[model samples]
Target: MPAALRITLTTQEHQTLKELEVAECVPRRTKQRATALRLNAKGGKVKAIADYLGWAQSTVRQTIHRWNHHGLAGLWEAKGRGRKPSWTSQDWEALEQWLQEPRSISSRQLSQRWAKQRQVFVGAEQVRRILKKKWRWKRFRKKPPVPKNPELKAAKKRDLQTLKLWAQEDLITLLYLDESGCCSESPLYYGYSPIGQQKSISQRSRKGRRVNIMGVWEQDNRFEYTLKVGTYNANSYLRFMEWQAQKAMKRLFETGKPTVIIHSGRFNPSCQGS
Candidate 1:
């Protein structure tokens, strides 16, 4: 038989190991206890303990040496050994403060400010991640500008009130009319797609087709007006309005004094009294 490697531990060290085993505060304490027992009581060498436990010989020796020197505290691993944080708490606080500012800022602008103010260089993607994840921010695109005309708004409101009053008195008349432009060349609707299926090529075509649609709608049914002109201008729209009014009058003459409501485009003067 090969000679056995002798292992030794002082009485004080053995007593401390016993206390640590009893405490069992840290993770892997049982393993540490078994190692200590094999070393102190069973006279198992470092190599033997390592072989039995399937750990490195240096690991076994270090565990025993740590318990001998620093007692229980040495067995616990040090903080921040696995992976370092991308940004510190202070950096996060600074970023939040910057985001809370009233002025609208782009990602690139924020990145530049971060470098100057925090003295830390970070990419736009990192800044975006911090903003979205940490701050729960969302991106918004501004809406298209609407034509502002206070006079027109006031006139429309007045017209609506007048129509409502006529309606209550049983003198109200309503006609629904609208014109829509249709095109064969559809507008591109941009949106996100999964990574692998993303399209890389674009389609190009110079000549496309288009058609215009015009119609009138009422509570009961719809009256589709002729395409009239290729493009419906204010003149063509006025003509459509005349046609709808004449049709309504003829129906009212035959059906008696029934109330009529006219819904027409802004450019149509059909609502105006003759």
Candidate 2:
């Protein structure tokens, strides 16, 4: 009959294995192997060590053989035992710092930065996983800063809903007007030019004059007006609104429907708006 496996350890080897238990830097497999070796060195049977450590007998034997051959280095797992990590904990720490910085960065851009800084090629998906799983980072879209008036925004939404309901009831026609203004610094458009012919730079220059224009956005038709006011004021805006309301009422009167003019301060005679 084959004799039972007998493993023994020296004093230095025993101390090193004990230290591995408290060592946080050692890998999990290394710690487990160290514990197994420690148990075996104290006259513990191979089967007992394996059962105590919840490891296979073959694993315990392999660890013993490795320790007998390589000593301290044997405590570590062999190379290529598992998948290689493209990034280390230090890389993840740097990534977390970057994420904490108040700036917008996309996953693709972050991967590029990682590749450049770490001098290692990493895929966006892999980086994304590292950020999500390792760092628990969340994805969010950046939006332009608007009013913080959520209540006002909610009110506007309710008003829009009411308008939609009114439209369904034929209460009033919805003429969504999109007003705009162009100044000498703003490009309204290029003047009329022959087809396939480019106009001169002087003619296309927006510095020539300033103009304000508005278009009624409704149905398949639109009424656009161009006005030139050096500085738009309340009077110019009121005139524009009055003109639009006149046109709207004219159409409503033809249809025998009451005219309800819903106007707010939205006209700019001068370079303010169009």
Candidate 3:
């Protein structure tokens, strides 16, 4: 066999290798290289060091060669040493522009669009990786509703605040009234199940009659609600309001404050008599 490759380390180089060999933060391969260099400096042969470290003999030789040429820098990898990304900055810019559209796009659709636009086919997995890692984008279930007239919404909010201040001073009793309806057949969409099993629920009927609720809430945490089997028409709502008004009159006399009812939805002129 040819003479065993031997390298002599300077005092600084030896100390650096000693520290790197024991360092916890460095990569395993870097630590291994440091250890191999230290051993070689102590007159350990290539094959012997390779056997002790469980590395191929050629790998040890390459490490020694790199250390000889590049010194401490050879212990870690250099940048741009692996496969390059296929997408460029221009491609990402185009993707950003595409994302500005009013609708959502899935990774599969994005990949297809990219292939169509650039003639470079990329998989959905790759597109997802780019979106998550490069763009730092996430998918959401729903977007919040935006008002048609923002200025009008702001004006209404300011009016509500003014009413709230009046209510706080006992100048008025502010009551919020609303109506909602829900079907009994609405099924629960989510539940937990044992691993690898599906969750399910049994129901006698898949469809059921709608239950309508008309409720009023006072600023003082008071609540009154009336339930109906079907919908609440103008006549039924007027009757409910009359009942609430009669109940409010008793408290109005005791508190000596005028009651102001606030309804956010459409109001029928027929209910004005109540």
Candidate 4:
């Protein structure tokens, strides 16, 4: 079937293996590996070496190959080679069940629970690694809030997909509208100016009033924004909507394309001046 594995050892190599095979404090596994190599060097057959050492023929062949490739280093166990994982299939099944509980569990808490039930001490880091590498679990910043109406939410999501398709096909332009305010006292912390000049911000008053900004952004990067001296009110918002309507009508008249505007549905009391 295949050629028999063989090895030839130098005088110095044989002496070193012999000493390692009989060293009082050497681990038994290392001694076995050393003896297997020594026997192969002395013309012992794989099957005969395995029978003598009570190891499998495959193990003996592996020993000969390893010694040929790695010399003496292969006589010791390789890094990350040792006992099989203590967590069995049943243990993983139990872990899966634990994860399905309504209440969430932290990795450290789960490790403690695992130690109590299985009588084995696995650290939180190890538990996290297994969850990520083996189970493909991910870390999320926070859980999303449960919607009050899930069916409506699903319908809205489907509608959004349809809208995106329409926008991609140029059937309609999609725009997003948002509003926020900032105070002059909190100027941008950083800005670029000439090499010798420090950028300066000038305010009309020592304590400047808030500047309200309303902006509408099109999916294709076109946008319009307005800055108001005071907070936005219902009348101001209505005026902005009217301006957008006029712009959309002009675009439709010229390009024959319709437009759809989307905004966060949350109502702001300030928007109504209430």
lDDT (10s digit) by residue, model 1, range 1-274? 4344444556775666566655534345454644555464566776777777777777776776666676556667677665465668898777767655433456677788878888778888867644553343333222323554889979988987787676566564545566665666554423222223332223222244456667776545556567742556566666866787787788789766554545553323333343
Better of 1 and 3 by lDDT: 3
Q: Please report the candidate that would top TM-score against the real structure.
A: 3
Instruction: Give the number of colliding residue pairs in candidate 4.
Output: 1
Report the CA-based lDDT of candidate 3 relative to the real structure.
0.75
> With candidate 4 superimposed using the best TM-score fit, by how many Å does residue 239's alpha carbon deviate from the native?
0.8
Residue 111 of model 3 has an lDDT of 83
Model 4 lDDT tens row, 1-274: 5588888888998898899887756778889998888888788888899999999988888877878788788778877878678788888778767765534366788789888997657898978766753343333222233434888878988988998899999899898888877786644333222233343333222245688888899865788988898767788888988999999999999989998987854424355352
Ranking by lDDT: 3, 4, 2, 1
- The residue-by-residue lDDT of candidate 3 on 99-201, one tens digit each, is 6554446778888988899765789897865665434343322322432478887898899999999989879889998877687654333322223334333
lDDT of candidate 2 over 1-274, digit per residue (tens): 4366666767886787899987755677889988887877778888898899888888888888888789889887667888788778888777667665544456687789888898657888877655553343333333323434789868977987888677678776766654555675634222222233333322222234455555555445455564654444566666867887787779777875554433333432353453
Q: How many residue pairs clash in each candidate?
A: 8, 3, 0, 1
Quality of model 4 by C-alpha lDDT: 0.74
Better of 2 and 3 by TM-score: 3
Q: How high a TM-score does candidate 1 get?
A: 0.34
- Which runs in model 2 stand beyond 4 Å of their true positions? 86-94, 99-274
Candidate 4 Cα deviation (angstroms), residue 216: 0.9
lDDT of each: 0.58, 0.65, 0.75, 0.74
Tell me the spans in candidate 3 whose CA falls farther than 4 Å from its real position: 1-68, 71-90, 139-158, 169-171, 177-215, 225-258, 263-274
What is the TM-score of each predicted model, taking all chains together?
Answer: 0.34, 0.35, 0.45, 0.36
